[model samples]
Structures are given as structure tokens and as C-alpha cells.
Target: MQYFIILTFFLYGLVFGSFFNVVGLRVPTKSLFNPKRSYCDTCERTLTWKELIPVWSFAVQKGRCRGCRQSISPLYPVMELTTGLLFAFTYYLTGFSPELMLGLLLISLIIPVTVSDIVYSRIPNRLLLFFSPFFILYRILYPLSPFYDSFIGAGFAFLLVLLIILLSKGGMGVGDLKYYTLFGFIFGFSHFLLLFFLSTLYGALAGGILMKMKKAGRKTKIPFGPYIGLAALTVFYFGEVIISWYLNLFL
Candidate 1:
């Protein structure tokens, strides 16, 4: 049974990873589910089913478009693999419960948001707009209250970033504020503080490292959405353990 569950998770991850590829590519352009076909960005030729089979197809085709033989970015396979691993981890952590479903949905949403923000430095309001109602519905269905927790999370996150932006003379972008507002709803007020701290810590550390290595200029802009996504995933998976660890250290 355990092995079966693992296999199920692996298969589910593979399928969802494929869908995420579409989302990552199309969501930015607002072309998701439009034109009803996948095309080579380079050659503009429609991709056949054989060319679209997620990780395996990339391997078989040697990471080149079939129509134009243009070399496709290996990032596609890497994203698919990363998403697959994340799903597998979520399944292992939550098993076959409501938490598992919620985790999957949250991770799925985060993947595209992360990619979109990293690539375009923008988080489309459409992504959050579409998912916000779902978050509310899930909270209601689960009967998790203070129904206002979601709003509180958004308000707090926005204000916190707003302060940073003001202090730094607009170091933070409005896109980040928008992203975190929706992200806060997913995390809710109960964990918002923790998530914010963790994400800010990670983002600062990462940005500092990049600056030290001279890969990023001191003033270079970096997207914050991925850090927020990472922090949310951490809280979802290990909030209790982390909180306990912190309390033990202090008390």
C-alpha cells in the first residue's frame, strides 16, 4: 500500500508537471487554453501529441523542437522534475487527505506564479484573481475560521512590504505586493507572520549571495514571489515542527 501510494504520487506529479508547463508558458501571455493547440515558440509550428509528453518527450526529442529542430530550453524538463519532486514530497507528508489536495493545489498555483515572476518580473492578477475565490471556498468548506484571517494576511503582508518599499525608496515592486496579498490568503493570518519572516530571510540571504558573487548588482531587482512560494510550502509542510523548535530554543 505504501509503495502504491508513492507510485500514485509520482504519476500524479508527472501529469500535473505537464500541465504546469502549459501554465508557465501560456499564463504570462494570457493565452492559456487559447488557440487550442501547443506550438513551437521558435518555429511557430503546432506540436503533435508525441512531442508533448512532458519529461520523456523532451528526452526522446533531444530537447529540440520537432518541426524546426530548434533547441528547446532545458528549463522545461527541470521545471517538470522539480514540480514532480515537490508533489511527491507533499503526498508523502500529507498522505491521501484534504491537506494533500490543498497542498497540491497550492503548489500547482505557486509553480506558475514563481516562474512567471522570475521570468517576467510580473505576477499576473489573473492568476490570483482566479484562485482567490477557490481559497475562500476551501476555507469555508473546511470551516477554518476566523474568516477574516485571509484578509488579515493580505493586509499585513501588503503593509509590511509597503513599509519596506517606502524606506528603500521603492526597492520593492508593486507586483510583489499583489503577489503577497494573494499568497497571504493561501497561508492565512495564523501563519502569515511566520511565512513572511521565513520568505524575507530567504530572499535577503539569496539576494546577498548574488550580490556578493557579482551576479546581481546591489541595486538589481529580484522577484519576491518565488521566496513567498517557498516559505508557504515550508509552513504548510513543517509549521508545527518549526514552531516547536523555535519555542524550545526560547523557552
Candidate 2:
């Protein structure tokens, strides 16, 4: 039974990963809602059903468009596979619960934002905006917790990032501030501060490594959304455990 659930989760990841590819490719160009089938950008030919299979299809085709034999970007398969692994891991961690559903939704939001920010150095507000309502809905579905916590989280995170931006003389982008609001709302006030602290630590460590390797210049900007996404995922999976550990350290 456990094996079956894991297999199901893997298959689910593959399917959603395919959809995420569409979202990542189209959302940035404002073509996500277009009523057209997927097509090869190089050849302008509609992709066949076989070509549309997630990670395996790319590998089978040698990462080329069948119609034109143009070399497709490896990023497609990488994104698909990454999402698939992350989704499966998330399911394994959360199982089939409301938390799992919310976790999946959060993961979906993170992938596009991560991909876009890495490629374009900007996160679309539209994507972050979409996550806002989910906070309210989460509250509705799980009402034992106070909805006000979400608002408090949002406000606190916004102010915290805003202060950092001011101190750094416009170092932070507005999109990041908006994105934190979603994180704050979902995480709530109780855990939001820890999430921010941990995310900032991770982001700084990552950025510092990139700088040391000379892959990024000292002043070269790195997107913060991915770090927030990572921190959120961590909190979702083990918030109580982490909080308890922190409290134990002091006590």
C-alpha cells in the first residue's frame, strides 16, 4: 500500500510537471490562457501528444523537436524532473491530508516563480497575487486557527522586508515584498518570523557562494523568491519540530 501511494505520487508529479512547463513558459509571455495547443517555438509546429510526455518524452526524443529537429532547451526536462521529484517528496512528507493539498499548491507557485526569477531576474506580481486568496481559503477550510494571524503575518513580513530595502537603498524589489506577503499569510505570525530569518540566511549563503565562485558579481542581484519558497516548504514539513528545537535551545 505504501509503495502504491508513492507510485501514484510520482505519476501525479510527472503530470503536474508537464503543466508547470506550460505555466513557466507561457505565464511570463502572458500567453498562459491562450486557446492554442503547445507548439515548438523554433519550428512553429504543434507538438504531438507523444512529444508532450513529461521527462521521459524529452529523453526519448533526444531533446529535439520532431518536426524541425531543432535542439530543445534542456531546461524543459530539468524543470519537469525537478518538479516531479519535489512533488513526490512533498507527498511523502505530508501524505494525503489538507496540509498536503496546501503544500502542493505552494509548491506549484514556487516552481514558476523560481524558474522565472532565475531566468529573468524578476517575479511577476500576477503569480504572487494568485496565491493571496489561497490563504483565505485555507483559513476557511481549517478554521480552528484565527484568520487574523494571516493578516498579522503579512503585515509583519512586509514591514520587515520594507525596512531592509530602505536600509539597503532600494536593494530589494517590490515583487519580493509582495511575494513575502503570501508567505507571511500562509505561515501566519507565529512562525512567520522564523521563516523569514531562515530564508534570509539561506538566500545569503547561496548568494555568497555564487559570489565566491565568481558566477555572480558581488553586486549582482539574486532573486529572493526561491529562498522564501524553500523556507516555506521547510516550515510546512516540520514547523512544530523546528520551533520546539529552537525553544529547547533557550530553555
lDDT on C-alpha atoms for all candidate structures: 0.81, 0.81
Question: What lDDT would candidate 2 get against the real structure?
Answer: 0.81
Model 2: ten consecutive residues of lowest lDDT: 138-147
How does each model score on TM-score? 0.90, 0.90
**Model 2 per-residue lDDT tens digits across residues 1-251:** 97678777877888887787677667777678888888998988988889998888899999988989999888788877877777788778878888788878887888888777776777787777786677668777875267678888989999988998889975678878888877887888868888888889999999989988999987777878778878888788788899999899999
Residue 234 accuracy (lDDT) in model 2: 79
Off by over 4 Å in 2: 67-70, 144-146
Clashing pairs in 1: none
Per-prediction backbone clash count: 0, 0
Model 2, C-alpha of 197: deviation from truth (Å): 1.8
Best candidate, lDDT-wise?
Answer: 2
Q: Which residue pairs show collisions in model 2?
A: none
